[model samples]
Target: MNQEFIDHIKALIKNKAQSQLKDELQKLHPADIAELLNDLSYTEAKDIYRLLDNEIAADVLVEMDEDIRKDFLELLPSATIAKRFIDHMDTDDAVDLMRDLDTEKQSEILSHIDDVEQAGNIVDLLKYDEHTAGGLMATEMVKVNENLSMPECLKEMRAQAEELDEIHYVYVVDDDDRLQGVFPLKKVITSPSVSKVKHVMKKDPISVKVDTPLDEVAQIIEKYDLVALPVVDSIGRLAGIITVDDVMDEIREQAEKDYQLASGLSQDVETDDNLFKQTKARLPWLLIGMIGGMGNSILIEGFESTLTTEMSYYIPLIGGTGGNVGTQSSALVVQGLANSSLDSKETVKQVSKEAVVALVNATIISMLVYIFNFFRFGPTAIITYSVSLSLFSVVMFASIFGTLVPMTLERLKIDPAIATGPFISITNDIVGMMFYMMLTRLLS
Candidate 1:
């Protein structure tokens, strides 16, 4: 809604027109209500949120921004949280909300849940690392036995389907509850009632282990174009299922985090986050960049006589080019790693490719600078050759350095995106200045 509509709602809130406010909010989708709540004060949000029905309130709670939801939940009692929100949420979402609460609060909320089985499932899921398939999956999917006849399987599926939002596949399992196959809904009509579930279902269906990494799970779903992927335990028993929507949400959160790290933030920081959190995420890198700048100044001071002020004139051209080239190279390598297109096994090949591209860029850039210097300072001046050679060396070194750092980080099990941040930019700047001074000293 626009600011004008929000203002109208705020006016209703101020006037304490409960019925009118309730009527207007009832008309909004859960996502829209969540958005509207985000734009209001805690008092206003709480007042408006109370008017929503339990199911819509649970959905709106899930849709609300994480920061807002955290604060909003704090004002509520544990019993209220369990009854009004947790009762209506899917197991996965409930676990997520539980994770945000303190240990004492979590126990209180869990105790208030009416569904003992669902509460147990949430507790079981919470044991896994949040970055695993086990944590991301929901226990709400439909599963039937392989021994059932077609008619029996269909009956079981219909009963379970009523409880779920949508049925992507009806999982078939053995008497041991081990996954045997996936039952296609089309087969329900096409296959005869006389056939056994195992005989008609798609056998040896693709699935991921519960302990599989979340990223690997996303890759499997993406590769096979699955709407839902079943999770299995160590013994191949069906555990839970991860839906496409959950995977998409995970992907978006991961992308945002990677972007923040690449931009030099240590952790995720929203604009609305408190001042200390914002500063905390941003300060360490700014301090590191400061140290790098000081190091550059000291290096230049040490070579004040050799640099001869004339060559110093192009320090910006040399440093800027190196930083820009390094940033470009690191960004591409990070991107390739994220999308799985570039494997660490091909490190030498990737670096060699970047080197060749660097050579072409270096030659063009250095030669262009050399020509400009020839006209700007006389052709016979040391400034001409030294500037061009320094640019050439800086470009080549920066390119190779940039490409290698991320690849090495990946091999060492560190995040490669860190290399694409101020880490690359500052390192290249300092090193580029050193190359410039050394080249100028040699030429003179």
Candidate 2:
């Protein structure tokens, strides 16, 4: 699907040129147009979007990344964006787009949205925190009274068919509008006319509270394999449903955030972000690393006299091998943390695998380092055996710490993201240095 449409559109845009691109974009569905837009130059995309209907434009805008959407909004004048276009969007998307706009611009966009119901919906959706169920759910779910017979349920659902295009399940609610159960569309259509919705509905549907963390919600969704899940208020009244598509987006966003945090950048870092912002986000980490390196320099200075007196030919060789060993251990532990594949049940297995991998690499590299030094310096290289042993011990200990630190942090209610950044690097460096010094002393 990605290749077929994208290639065809590419030929149209690139071969036929800008005028043809604009004309071709008009013929595409909003989602398809969105895909095409993603591939185009920002100026070309803007021009093509102007040629399309506002309703189509709005749909594509919602589908776009926040960067592209913000840029598009900046280009379009308020008058061209119709009330129907804004009204057609889901409340969550509307709120997200609006939140990016300046207060005055947000008000201007809101003023253009004349539909009171849509306006109120966007307002209500904006009230919830972004990580919670209220922020994640779509307001487009189907609801019906519990008293309705299966025939009545079918009739009511059919009556509302025009308004329920995206409906996957129908909710059963009490007179007070509190959710009692949910009935999938298939069940309603297949059940006997005499059977009430109560007889067919799932009494306790999988749901998340409005304030539940996004990660926890994602975990529940994964654990249950739910195509869609309902969101409820503190009072247990159903508000909306979060779809699989939205959950997938949340997962990608979270993964990106983890990457950025691990690299010591802002969670919002993007290719389109300004240079100054990117630098500001990255500067702290570089500075911290520099300071940490300075500490390493100081430690080396303290050991300088010992090194000078020992006059070891194997120092360079040992240093190179130890660095490589420490790096390999750090990489494995980081991978294990990111995958969450290492848990208490498999802790022993993961540690053993890590140890074997680290040990093998350390031994091979250290043996080569010792061999080269022995040939070059004649018996002075015996010190390398001690250096190699120390490096092996450091890597083994570092791997264990790397695995346990995140686990312990999570248990203590700290975000595990902290373990990925300066924390891990600094801790590993300290441990690695200690290993080097201890080995040097024993060898001397």
Once fitted onto the true fold, the runs of candidate 1 whose alpha carbons sit more than 4 angstroms away are none
- My TM-score estimates for the predictions, one after another, are 0.97, 0.81
lDDT of 1 at 172: 93
Which tens-of-lDDT digit does each residue in 284-400 have in candidate 1? 999999999999999999998896767767888888988899989999998898778899879999999999999999999999989998998889999899989989999999999
Measured with C-alpha atoms, the lDDT of residue 218 in candidate 1 is 85
lDDT of each candidate versus the true structure: 0.91, 0.70
Model 1 TM-score (2 dp): 0.97
lDDT of 2 by residue, 235-322 (tens): 8888888888887887788878767876677456777679988888888888887887788767767777556433445444434444
Q: Highest lDDT among the candidates is held by which one? A: 1
The true-versus-predicted C-alpha distance at residue 4 of model 2, in Å, is 15
Query: Model 2 segments beyond 4 Å from truth?
Result: 1-23, 26-32, 35-46, 75-84, 308-382, 411-414
